[model samples]
Target: MLYCKDCQLLCEQECPQCGSRSLRKPQANDPVLLGVFEPAIAFGVESILKDNHIPYEKFGNLGAAVTLYVGTAMETYRFFVPYGEYRKSVSLVEELTGPAEPSQEHE
Candidate 1:
């Protein structure tokens, strides 16, 4: 597999979505995305990461105002971990919730 620098995604040939040929091996510190999920799964993922002592970052699509009014039901979160810890994190998450789906939107 190759990493697409342009899209920040791991793909075989060109990027599966962008068709870009700019791909290379992923770097150790590159922030590899785990997945995008809703509140329930996102919180669980956070817990797993914390319990395992793996550093991670999460971002929400909606702003504070929107979330405050509409609540988190419509909110979606994106989780990322350094490439070095990616495999371990993926395995841990998969054991409990199966594989998390890759993100479709560009960051």
Candidate 2:
């Protein structure tokens, strides 16, 4: 598999999205966004990644501070994985939390 470093896309032949031939094998340190999930689901995602032997990084959003005073219901966490393992990690996470929906941006 080849990865378009600029577009952060995984492809077999070439990056169809960016039409860039400057692709290379994915590396263990390349970070990719897996998804942003609720606290409950984030814990599950961490466990699944560990079981699958995938390295991951987790970060809390601004709402996380509120959780310290309020509760976890309002908190969200972002998950990232090595770009090399992103595809597999995504599949595993989807099984636990269903597929992620695309976000809409207002401009």
State which candidate has the highest lDDT. Answer: 1
- Please give the CA lDDT of all the candidate structures: 0.83, 0.76
Clashing residue pairs in candidate 2 are none
Error of 1 at 2 (Å): 1.2
Give the distance in Å from residue 66's predicted Cα in candidate 1 to where it truly belongs.
Answer: 1.7
lDDT of 2 by residue, 8-105 (tens): 65567777667888889888778766777777888999999999999888877755567788887877787778887887998998899787675411
* Model 1, span 9-88: residue lDDT tens: 77788887689888889998787777777899889999999999999989898978999999999999988888889899
Q: Against the true structure, what is each candidate's TM-score?
A: 0.84, 0.65
By summed lDDT, the worst window of 10 consecutive residues in model 2 runs over 98-107
Pairs in clash, predicted candidate 1: none
